[model samples]
Target: MKLKTLILAITFLATFNLFAQNTYVFLGSYNRDKTAEAIQVYQLDTLKGKLSKVTSAKDIINPSYLTLSPNGKYLYACTDTKTPNAGSVSSFEFNPENKSLTFLNKQSSGGENPVYVSIHKSGKWLVNANYTEGSVSVHPLLENGKIDSLAQNFQYMDGSTNKERQTRSHVHSAVFSPQNDYLFLPDLGVDKIRCYQFDENKKQPLVETKSPFTKTDLEAGPRHFTFHPNQKFGYCIEEMAGAISVYQYENGTLNKIQRIYTHPDKIKSGFESSDIHISPDGKFLYATNRGKENNIAIFSIDENGLLKNIGYQSTLGKHPRIFAIDESGKFLIATNVLTGNVVVFKRDQKTGMLKKTENKVKMENVSCVQIKRI
Candidate 1:
């Protein structure tokens, strides 16, 4: 009996050590031209805060945003961004051993300037939102990670109070609810959150729920959203208003609970909040403010699922567009698009603060970053 117990202990320790050692970083950028490589993979040195380039995938233009499959075997990205009538979503087969991405297939995004792509939890469906054209496209995923033809497309025709920025529908992101039964789309032009019930068993998976959409503050221009780890709360960053709108989530509905501005008042950057994320432990939240603010707004989550502004940390560059926290919540990396720099930060678990490190990488027009441990 003692020998068997000793063997079980050894197996647990081995698994823990293996998990602690493997971390990979994926970055997407805007290509100067079609010949430039746009998607890159790097081996992240967690201890030394270094990024070692592994391989880069080419032949696709402006692969700006990226996401991985549930099993981490595949990667998908929005291609040809800012190119009129040429937007697409492409898939790649990722091999962890060789640390390479093999091009697979791509499907038209149904609209121009496709910005964000997300896969359903079941891994059977993939959806993308077009920013400039105000449209959403859905494609069925084949078993081998190849993207099939476009299935359904929805074009939104609406606008909000801001005449210059919100004169037409601009869908910024498509986020699936924690339950995977609903999809919440933050439309910057319309100033609303459109909700759709997803039935994966049917050919037409996206249908409007009883509550079709929720209205945001008149000129908020809701851009990106995230749900709390506990699944009881939701938060969205308003790009135009420069604030976060908090909501209570249930089934497929969002009830507004609180709203808070992310940055200090009267800054020169004027309020260009970009990305929002909650720590893995659910204790803290972080957001990036662009337009010369170049800082991350830090907040602590209370038990009641509300936020209290703790402090702000400089991203060490300008135009901090998108930032991501690793699954372990030990590190955060922010990408400054205009500055052509990606800066790393170590997170303090107890204080919920970020300290910048010297580990930085130079890449022009770096738009997005994601970290995952394999």
Candidate 2:
């Protein structure tokens, strides 16, 4: 009887490995006209690399960035962007059963050009980074998937060395640390990453950490950040420098470890690093280059969390702004903002390479892409 039970368990494990999980892809775009399908949802056929349109939410102006709640029930996006003093974060209720996103409500983003949004792992806290005005907005999340009014707006006062770009604070992204006990705001205008301790129980959850911020190289212009799966290392992609800064992450502190260029040629002219993400298995890191390069730089992570440049994959589209790897690490989808093309690529798990597949779709101003397994 023991032999039979052992064989049954082995058989079950093999069956599970043969089937991948159901994946849903979420897309956000720039809709300055407030029409033409601003946000969309698609179901990914993992085996074939096919993307089927599930739903589209329209009339939300400039839903350029998006984040999902921890529970996967709430979807939030930056709306009314690029307009002075009118930016807002809108919320939607995601119905996985029907693959639909129902519009919920919106709250003021507290500044202009709200470009990025991030939510805490607990699903109780949400934050937005206003780019043009250089501020951070904090909001509370209700149990019913509604976003509460703005609780705090932290504004930056100074800039960095670049006269053309850094004359004023431009907060590009707000991301929570791996442990969710800290929040980090990357200031492109200041060339510094501001840190703050967070306590969800407090009326205002964001407060200055012992180390208030980490200064990046002058004119680095940090845009996006991501943490490793082991929770011991973090990466910040600097737009202006076209490089990534590695850090040793502990508690609320980040100690710089190494800086590496994303491109091999070290070209100076027209390249901006836009987004960064680690594979679900933490074996590889990828960053999108938006300007003239328009490619995704791939790096292999060592045992100690240092990165070694491995290869570069052309996005097969122009202005590759954001790309997301599926939870299975078998598929990667990249969105090109200028060409409005969303291309799907099959990922080689062993070598960390991406090959373009025939599966592709076009949406006007498609700027962000995210994939999650359900």
Task: Evaluate all candidate structures by whole-model CA lDDT and list the values in order.
Answer: 0.90, 0.90
List residue ranges in candidate 2 displaced over 4 A: 1-21
- TM-score (all chains, Cα) for each model: 0.96, 0.94
Which residue pairs in model 2 clash with each other?
none
| Model 1 backbone overlap count | 0
Worst 10 residues of 2 by lDDT: 14-23
Off by over 4 Å in 1: 2-17
What digit string (tens of lDDT, one per residue) describes model 2 on residues 10-114?
999988965634678999988777657889999999888999998989878888788888767789999988775689999999887876889999999999989
lDDT score of residue 355 within candidate 2: 94
Tell me the lDDT of candidate 1.
0.90
What would the per-residue lDDT of candidate 1 be over residues 125-147, giving only the tens digit for each residue?
99999999999999999999999
